[model samples]
Target: MFKRNIFICLFLALVISCGGDGKEMISLHPMQEKMAYADHETIMLELNEVSGLNHHMPKSLLIIHQYLNNETTSGFITNDLSVLTTDKVQISTINDSSILILEPSNNRLIQYDIEINSYEIISDQGRGPGDLYFAEELSTFNDKAFVGMQGFQLSIFDCSMDLCVYEKTINTDFNNYSIDATEDQIYVLGISPFGNPQDSDPLNSDHNLFHILNYQGDVLNSFHPAYDDRSPLVRNRLSSGGMIKTYSNKSLILIAFDFFPYLYEYEAGGDLTNIFQIDNFVQPIYESKESLHSGFSAGLIYGNKTVIDLTTRVDDEWLFLRLYERRNIGFDHVNVTFTGDEWYTYLAYNVERRELYKLGDDIKTTPGDSRVLHVLDQGIMVNNDGKLKYITR
Candidate 1:
């Protein structure tokens, strides 16, 4: 995150009020406290026990003073970056000095030097001794690129050299939804295909949606974020509503759930720490489900559901969260677009202070499939016109 300090002078007025007894009192007022709208009543978050939290209130709010696409930002986006298609490139793993882009189609890893305005293709796609096959996940730790693919394969590419060299591959047993790592351990969000027997409601079978694995591809322990037993149809509706995102710092793992205003922290060795939550978000509707039609057809009995879809991108100091209230048809069944009270808001959780900061409604992350979006150290990748638009501090 590049910091260009813009100082603005403010006039502070002190008002002294004189009581009837001739006592003078300084007048004070509360600051804006309410963050945003929520699904239900605001659940006060009591985050008392947390460590390594150095959250500080922003001295100045961030604004998009410049845009970095293949243009502008004083040529920061660079010409080589223009070759990246919007569908193929990912901007989630960027830092202050460099920007990382992952092209899943070809299994290519690109890193752009922000200061020099240049790009380099670090990793290539292949199937030799150390190549990528079905590369579905990409994350960076130190100078290594962690690639997760089908057949439960985890590959590490050494990016210290000019071109990334495949170092080692760890085998696992998960169709990975997302995977990231630290120096000692790796975290995985595996997609479990669970279905009801026929049409009956399903019970909590103690399914583990979160998996913690060692570098050698062995599962140390699994976390079952259990939910109440609901019918498959109901479960399907609520499943897509909330988001489950993870963040790790080579040791500490922060797991955020959008169903409520909470984030769970864990050690690299799978020890649960503190469960952090925000006490002051506007309550959102979490349990609003209705049957579509009594008449049962094999395929399409169209219904509508609105969910508080939450997504997050983690940085060094702040874990950026974007919340969206999306209303769509159940299971994407009907081709017809369903619409309702769709809204979006942004919040930043200071990892150091263990506090939530309301990054005003000015700059926000766009709503999408909740895979790590175009996120940088101090900026967020804006949805652009077939181009990359980045907003930094």
Candidate 2:
């Protein structure tokens, strides 16, 4: 069953790419030379420009949460030092004074008003219209909130008023993992539909990877990372799903794969501009497997200490990445001892300086503790006592 699932995922990537509209696709390739690791250096990031981001540069600090072991938790500290905490919740800056939190566990969309020091559950939990179900991803565009939920559904809410009013829902054709929006478009990172796992030939197109949509859920365009031609590992849908963020003002879309140690930057119009890598680490080691019962070729992995958790954030002058790896974890049905403190590394690249820096190396931190999760606009978001807090310079 384990190997079969891996085969199914790879097979799905091929099928979905081939089953889409027969438009010509754009292929991406990484630079030949990888960025070398430099000495420990810290660059301070400031949230200065706040028009598209909807929040002014806070004088104090704000932080996000981290994914520890197998859990993701975080807290949001308002500019006034008010704290709103939840488990597995994603927060988006609705405005300078308000924020939207997507609490997936309770299926609640909460609007927290920092000025009043209060929060209200704006949307209820259900399968009905305007309800939030297992919603994880959240982004704001044009005074609206885009909530990506389970069952391949996206809920859009109007936040122009005092209360967010649900507008409509978008039913996507793929399994969306993360999302971001520009001033006019929504970028969804998802895997194509699982057509027939037994299908042998992979059509290999960009539409199988990304889906660009308008506010009305109309697919304006579809494209994948420009590296599919260089790396075959990206053909597996499971490994390709990662974090995607759009710098609206910059007109840039940054993509970081969970398993691949590389960052891709593209123009909003689907042009690959730059590729980034920390140190000389390119890819993970994998052993092939074959199923005897079903005669399925499972070739992704067997045992490897690969990147299981990844985060990417790009500021004006620097790009930040946090990579976590686990050991002795086999893809097959073998159990291994739970070894805490598997390896955590933090790296940053300065675009202007054209240098790479390593901030942390194999830090001895446990889960639900002080593990770094994300690189924020102005500070680093770390997990403290199971709650996410920001550490400013």
Candidate 2 Cα errors over 4 Å, as ranges:
1-88, 104-106, 134-136, 195-207, 225-240, 280-282, 285-292, 295-320, 325-340, 343-364, 367-393
Give one digit per residue, the lDDT tens place, for model 2 in 1-393: 001011122222322123233322222222121111112132232223112322422211122212222222344342322444453456666665576767667778888665576778889789999998767577776589888764678888999998788999888876667777776788887665433685323445333466689877888776653223322333443334467777766667767676555556668876666655444342443322222232223234433444635444344445555666555532333543344445666555444544555444545454323444545444444543235454443
Per-residue C-alpha lDDT of model 1 across residues 54-117, encoded as one tens digit per residue:
2443311132212311223543432323444444344544345676666667777677665566
Top lDDT model? 2
- Compared with the true structure, the alpha-carbon lDDT of candidate 1 equals 0.49
- In candidate 1, stretches whose alpha carbon ends up further than 4 angstroms from where it belongs are 1-81, 87-89, 94-96, 103-108, 116-137, 192-204, 228-251, 258-261, 273-315, 326-343, 362-374, 391-393
Candidate 1 weakest ten by summed lDDT: 27-36
How displaced is residue 161 in candidate 2, in Å?
3.3
**Clash pairs, model 2 backbone:** 28-226, 28-227, 29-226
